[model samples]
Target: MVDRVAARAHETIDRVAAKAGPAVEKLRESASTYREQLHAKADRLGALEEQWIDSARSYVREHPFTSLAVAAVAGMVIAKIFSSSHHR
Candidate 1:
């Protein structure tokens, strides 16, 4: 009787493991696919960022005075925000 019970327990464990194996494999494949997609998106975003930086450089060079005025206004706004936060 004990031997039969042990055999039955072993069979149950094996069945459970078999069922779990395919589920685990599917999960691994899904994770790998997601990782690849994220890498592709990051590469595209990096290229876009480089393009924008180059465009900005050209614009700044062509209109230095305008860029300076914009920078000054932005700096003042940032300073005002920080100063107000500090007072609070």
Candidate 2:
């Protein structure tokens, strides 16, 4: 009886280990896929940043005074909005 019970327990452990092995492998596969997706997104973001930098530099060179005036006005508006909201 003791030998039978031990064998049964070992069998149960083996069964659980077998199930867990596949689950772990699937999780690893999913992580690898997510890493690939993130790399693709990072590449796209890099291209977008380069595009924006080139556009911004060109705009600054073309309209330095206009850009500075617009920036100053926008900053003043934002500061006023925040300052008023915080006071309230």
Candidate 3:
């Protein structure tokens, strides 16, 4: 009787595993697709960041004085914001 019970349990586990095989494979394929999509998006974002950096560099090179003035003004504004927030 004990042997019979053990055999039945093994059979049940085997059946469950067989039933789950296709579902597990489907999940793996879906995960691979999502991974591919995420990689593509990351690549595009990296390119966009490079483009923005290049454009900013060009702008600064063309207008060094203007860029310096803008940066100074921006710095003052940021400092004021931070100081006021701290006082509050």
Candidate 4:
């Protein structure tokens, strides 16, 4: 009778473990997918940052004063927008 009870207890433990194994596997799979996605996005952002740097260098080389003027105007516009928004 003691052996039978021990066998049933082990069977119940095995069943619970079997159910938990799939849930743990699913969590690991989702974490892997999310990690991969984040890495891909970081790579894309790196490429975009390099492109923007190249563009800015080229723009500065071509037109220093024009770039400054445009930047100032845009900054003023943005500030004005933000100031107006805050007032509301």
Best by TM-score: 1
Q: Where does the lowest 10-residue lDDT sum fall in candidate 4?
A: 59-68
Stretches > 4 Å off in candidate 2: none
Model 2, span 1-88: residue lDDT tens: 9999999999999999999999999999999999999999999999999999999999999999999999999999999999999998
Worst 10 residues of 3 by lDDT: 14-23
Question: TM-score of every model?
Answer: 0.92, 0.84, 0.85, 0.67
Better of 1 and 3 by TM-score: 1
- Predicted candidate 1 versus true structure: per-residue lDDT over 25-66, tens digit per residue: 999999999999999999999999999999999999999999
Can you give the lDDT of residue 35 in candidate 1?
100
If ranked by TM-score, best first, what sequence of candidates would result?
1, 3, 2, 4
Residues 1-46 of candidate 3: C-alpha lDDT, one tens digit per residue = 9999999999999999998999999999999999999999999999
Give one digit per residue, the lDDT tens place, for model 4 in 18-79. Answer: 99999999999999999999999999999999999999999998999999999999999999
Model 4, residue 5: distance off in Å is 9.3
Residue 76 displacement (Å), model 3: 0.8
Q: Report lDDT per candidate.
A: 1.00, 0.99, 0.99, 0.99
- Model 4 CA deviation exceeding 4 Å by range: 1-10, 82-88
TM-score for candidate 2, residues paired by index: 0.84
Error of 2 at 78 (Å): 1.5
Q: Which stretches of candidate 3 lie over 4 Å from their true place?
A: 1-4
